[model samples]
Structures are given as structure tokens and as C-alpha cells.
Target: MSRFELLVRGGTLVVPYVGTIRADLAVAGGRVAAIGLDIPVSDAATVLDATGKLVFPGAVDAHFHLGIYRPLSVDAAEETRSSLVGGATTVLSYFRTGQHYLNKTGPYETIFPEVLSSVAGHAWTDYGFHLAPMDTAQVREVPSLVEQSGVSSFKYYMFYKGFNLSADSRDAKAFTMSDEYDLGHLYQLMEAVAEAGRSADRRVSLSLHCEQAELMRLFIDRVRADGDPQTLKAYSDARPPLTERVAIGEATTLARATGCAVNLLHLSSGEALAAAREARAAMPGVDMRFEVTLHHLCLSYDELDGLGAKVNPPIRSHADTEALWDGILDGTIGWVASDHACCLEAEKGDELWPALPGFGGTALLYPILLSEGMHKRGLSPTRVAELVSANPARAYGLDGRKGNLLVGYDADLTIVDPDLEQEVTTDLLLSGQDHCPFEGRKVRGWPVATVLRGRIAYQNGQVVGSPTGQFVAR
Candidate 1:
């Protein structure tokens, strides 16, 4: 038998927190075995020449939504294929017992297993889930879910308390399965996370969607009555930054009291970013991390094409976009993610109010960062690696094996050719969803290949190998 399974030779490796170095990486048994110059080709089964390419640890996308808007099996196959093409080898998606996702109200004891079984053999990349307890019964299952299910993170949707997807409804109970998503329930959820952390083998975190429901409802009514319902600005005006700010304050306060680690997801506005900073200062001991989405970083409301850019916590102005970049530069933002939901074009109608929020961008994950952060903004390759790979791995409890380009870690990597430039188009994307909000835009830097567990899964904008992904236990 060969001593090494594969060798990636003559590449510029982007090591997190360390400067880039030219090295040859050896892989055996699906993990990085060695890193040095001129490993003997006789010892490996295959050699891939990576000359003139930038080799980065494959991105760990921490905030993905696969089965939420579509079938889990289909979403896993298609979206993860797109994610791999974009250089993400592993995806940690959020799943909950809700009206849209599993479409049931019950204990996770039955539901989570069904969720796991549904995507058992379908994904093209390694995958895990962060679950939300939508009711009291599900909340009581947190400890077991952590210990047995290998789920170390939980979610709280702050805007689902009494809000509706459309402007006409008054109650969110049918959607969330409970009327208890208020502050008291949030406190209890934090307490449960704290309790789980005491015995969990890894860190446990509570990820929150921090938009205040009552405030959003009021604003939505006013916007519907007074504003143009067809424009992206109207959506932004409806769920303004103050709503996110208030909810951030409330979440961090409860987190400080419960001593639970908290992650603020998809922060989109200047006011929200400022409030997140204040919350961190107020609770210096509480573990808190912030995430920004690709849409927030790349496009603002004034620049959007249509209602397809309408996401929850809607995109803000140019000033807010600048604020997000500042946060990323100053190290206040821990990571950037796609918040990728494969909402179809038909679902996103011309009308803004009824249009479904969220569109897939997993295929643009690394390209956008490479274009804006490295080519345009002067961010170093090291910082870009951390923003996409290392920070998210550390934040979401995947640091043991998923993040860095170190020996004994999974040999998951993406090779990018910085000189390759391409325009964003729907046909170029591998996602099942047909429309891209960023269509026709040009971006520099692109992924040339992706490796998962020493197997080449994507190369030259195509999926090259069979699905070799497994459930990643935290």
C-alpha cells in the first residue's frame, strides 16, 4: 500500500494568523499528514500540482439553511454541491421544528432523528445542524439533544413571537408552534444552553435572530399603509435597525445573566452593529460573537435589483454597508456567511410584502470575499482565511478538526486562482434555485478546486467526484 493517499504540491498555503508559505501538503487516511517541501511522489498514490494557486482551508459556513425552504434531500444534494464549488467543505445549518421546516410541532426527540435520516446519504459536503427549540417540550430536550444528538448549539428567533410572514396576520403561534418565544422563554433557553455547556464535550452556544417582533409588526403596518410596498427600501424601512438593536440588547442581557455563549446572526445595519458593540462592553465576561451576511457586505438597498434582495433584517444603506466593513476590519465581526436559503424565483414575486425572504448565495461565498476583501479592500489573505474559515470553526465548536491548515486536520481545502475573473450569473451557479440576486455583476478571484477528506469534489466549476460527506458530530 502507498504511504500517502494524495499530495498537493507546490502551493502557496494561507495559514490562519500566520503568513502564507509555499509548501507541499500530504494527505493520508483523509487527514493532513504532513506539510513540507518536495514530499516524494513515489510515496503517494496521486499528486496534484497546485502551482501558482492559493490554498486555503476549506470554508466552514456556519450559518446555512438547507432544508428550511426546500426538501432536505434535494437541498442537501444541490446546495451543498454549490457550496463545494464555492470552496466550502463543511456546512453547519440551522434546523428547527416550525411551519416551514419539518412542518410539525413536536418534540425534537422524534423530529431531529427524522431530520438526520432525511439527509443521511444525500449531501455533497460534510454537514451538521444547530437546532431551535420551538416549544416548551423541545426546550426540555436540549440536554439530550446536546449530549446524544451531537448538537452543541441552539437558536432563538426573536422576531417570531407575534410576527407573521405576511403583513395581515396577528399571531405567530402557528409558525413557531408556541406563544412562548418572548423574553422569559429566551431566558429559559439561555439557561438551558448554560446547563448543557457544563457537561458538553465542546462549547455550547445560543444563536439568535435578533429582530424584535412587536417593533417589527408595528413598523410593518406603518410601512404597508404609508410606503411603496414594491420597493426594497420599503422592506428596509419596515424592519429598521432599531428593531435589531433592541433585540440585541435584550439577548445579550439574558446571555450575561445566564452565562451562556451567544452568537448574533446576520447583523445588517449600523445601529445594530453599534448596539452589538455596546452589548459586548456591558457584558465583558459573556462570550459573544457577531456574524455578517454576504448580502449586507456586498450590496445595499439602494443598489438591489429587486425584491429578491429582500432578506430578513433587510439590507441597509451605503453607510450601513460601510459600517459592516469597518466591523470586519476592526475584528468586531467574527465571520461572514451566506445565510443561504434556496428560495425559488417564483416564490419571490414582484410585490415586496408577499415576496419570500432569502435567496441562495453559497456559490459566491469565497468569490465575494476574495473580490471585495482582498482585491478591493486590501485585506490580507490571512485575515480573509480567518473571516471565512478559522473564526467560524472556533465560534461554532468545529475547531478540533475543521478550521486550519494544520497537520492531523481534515484535508479539506480550496485552491483559488487570483487572476481568474468572472461575472455573476444564475447559470454559473450550481444551486437548485434559478435566480441570483448578484447576477450580471463582475467579481475577481475564483475557486479552481475543492477537496473534502482528501477527495476532489469540485474543480473547474464542476462537481468531479461522488458524495463522500458524513455527519460531523460536535
Candidate 2:
């Protein structure tokens, strides 16, 4: 009988918070079994020669919206294919009862199961969801949703209260069924999440999209009348840093009062970062985690390719990008993710104000981290592993199975050839979306292969097997 099912030989293994070592990794029954200078491969069912490559734990992209712009089934099949190409073995996508997702408002009892069924057999990588409670009725279902559905993390969009759209837009009720997505509702939601967390076996958290809606509404009117609303610069000006900072402060205060664990999503500017720091200082007991995205870290307003670069809490200036990098290096930022939303070219119009908010970046998750974090910023491979894998896995409650290369951890990994260089082009990407905001940018240290649970899912720029991904419960 074979001692192991698979053996990956002769690679430099990078473990987060641990230094690199050259070892052969062994896998049996879809879990890591051993690692050493030489693991006997004679009886292995499969063997991969990974000579001269950097092998790190497969990235866990903690933020994505697979079905926000496309049908759920279509988006899951295509976008997860793109995620595999970038070496992510696990994805935690955000779903809600809203206009963009399912375009319906109801109790999560029916809605969440539908969300799960839509992508059940289509994903190419293991997946889960972080849900948002949009109304009072939905808020009442949080405990059951967390307990029965195995969903540990919930979300609150701070800017969706009463005024969700622009000043001229009349579709507020279409997005949310509630008349009050206000602070009182947020406080109640936090209390419920905190209560659930107290009893749940795993860590439960609340993720917030921290931008004040009233500020956004007022500024959009000013920008349309006085400033040009069709430029990336104008988008940034309309939703300024102060709005994000103010919301962060308010949300953290409510979190403190309710004893809820908070995960602040996609902090875009220096002011936001500063406010997060202040909140942490003020309320030492509130558990808070901060997140930054690839777009925020890599692309700035100066380098945007047009309407495609526009996103919620829009990408900021070059100085803001530098500040984010500083936070990443100094351990203030908890993790990095691709808020990958596959908005197509047709939806992203020529004018920035009318274009859809998000673009696909899951295909660039690992390469961009290596190109910028390791090559340019002097970040160690271990740090890169934590930023993309370990920390996120812990944050979203997949810590035991997904994050590191350990004796019992899932055999999920990405092998990168540091010498290889590639350019970002729409043709090179696997997303169903036709355009890329990162088009024409050159990056190095690309992922050459990806391993998911002892099987090679992607190698040499191609997906190897059919969709074998499963629903990962929290």
C-alpha cells in the first residue's frame, strides 16, 4: 500500500510567522502528513517536482462578490476559475438580500439557502459566505442563520441607511426593504451578533462597509454641480476620506457598546487608518480587525484606467497608497483581500459617475502581492503568506483547516516561480468580465501551480480538473 497519496518534492516552503525551509511535503487523505528534507516518494500515488519554486499556503481571499453583477451560477463557475488561476484555494464571498445580488428581500431562511444552492456545484475552490442583515425582519434571523447555516460572520453596510443611492436616484427602497438602516438598527444588530458569538464554538464577527451615506449624498451633488463627476479624481473627492473616518469612529463606538467583534472592511485613506487607530485606542476591549484591498494598495487615482477603476470608497491618492503599505508592514493592517466583483464592460460605462462600482482582481491576488510586497517593498515571503492566507483564514473562522502548512491542515498551496514575469492583459485573465483595470501593468513572481486538498487544480496557466470544491462551513 502507498504510504502517502501525494508527494510534492524539492521546494522552498514558506510558513507564515515562520522562516522558509527546503523540504518535501507529503499528503495523505487530503491533509498534510509530513515535511522534511526528503520524504520517500516511491509508494506515492502522485508526485509533483517543485524544484526552485517558492511554495506557500494557498491564499484565502476573504472578500469577494461572485454574483453581484452576474447570475450566481454563472459567476461562481467563471470567477472561481479565475481565483484558482491566482492560487486561491478558499474564498469567502459577501452576499446579502439586496438589489444587486438576488434583487429580492426576504428572511435569510429562504434567501441564504438559495444563495448556497446557486453555487453548490459550480465553484472551482472551497467557498463560504459573509451575510448582511438588511432589514428588521432579517435581523431577527441572525442567531439561527449563524447556528444552522454555519455562517459565523455578518455584515452591515453603514452607508445604506435611508439614503442608499445618489441624491437624484430614487431607487433606495429597491436596494433595501427597510426604512431604517440607521444606528439604532446597527446597535441592535451588533447586540445580536455579540450574543451569538458568546455561545458559538467559533469566533463570530461583524464586518462593516464604513462610509456615511448622508455625506456621500451631499458630496455627490456638489461634485456633479461644481466638479467633474466623470473622472476618478472626482469620485474620490465626492466620497472623501473624512466620511470613512467618521463612520469608522461611529461603528467602533457602537461595537464597543454592544461587545461585538468588528472587522472593518477596505480602509482607503490615511484619515481612515488614523481613525481606526483612535478607535482601538479609545476602546481597548473591542476586538477590531482592519482590511485593505489590492486596488487600494497597488492602484491610485493617478494610475486609473478610467471608469473601470471606480469602486466603493473609491481608490485614493498615491500618498494614501503609501500609507496603506506602511500599515501593512507595521502590523496595523490585519489582512489583504480582493474585493473581486465582476462588473462587465457593458455595465462600466465610459462616464465614471454612471459606471458600476467594482471590477475583478481575484486573478491577480498572489502575483500582485509578490510583485509589490516582496520585490518592491522588501516584505518577506512569510509576511506575504500571513497577509494573504493565515490572517484571513483566522479572521473568517477557517483557521484550523485552511491557513497554514501544518501536520493536520488541508494540502492547499501555491507554487511560484520568482523569475517569471507577466503583464496584466484582459486576454491573460480568466474572469468572464471583458475588461481589466490593471491592463498593461507588468508584474513578476507569478503562481505557476495551485494545489487544493492534495490535487493539482491549476498548473502552467491552466485549470486541471473539473469543479471539486465544497462548501466550507464555519
Query: What is each predicted model's overall lDDT from 0 to 1?
Result: 0.87, 0.88
| Total clashes in model 2, counting residue pairs 3 or more apart in sequence or in different chains | 0
Model 1: how far residue 447 lies from native, Å: 0.8
Runs in model 1 deviating more than 4 A are 164-167, 170-177
Q: Model 2 off-target regions past 4 Å?
A: 164-167, 170-177
Candidate 1 accuracy as lDDT = 0.87
Best by lDDT: 2
Root-mean-square deviation per candidate:
1.7, 1.7
Error of 2 at 367 (Å): 0.8
What's the count of clashing pairs in each model shown? 0, 0
Output the lDDT of residue 148, model 1. Answer: 88
Tens-digit lDDT track of model 1 for 376-453 = 998888898899899999887888699789999999999998778999988788889888888988999899999999
**Candidate 2's residue-wise lDDT over 416-471, tens digit each?**
98778999998676889899988999999889989899899999888887988888
Measure candidate 2: CA RMSD.
Answer: 1.7
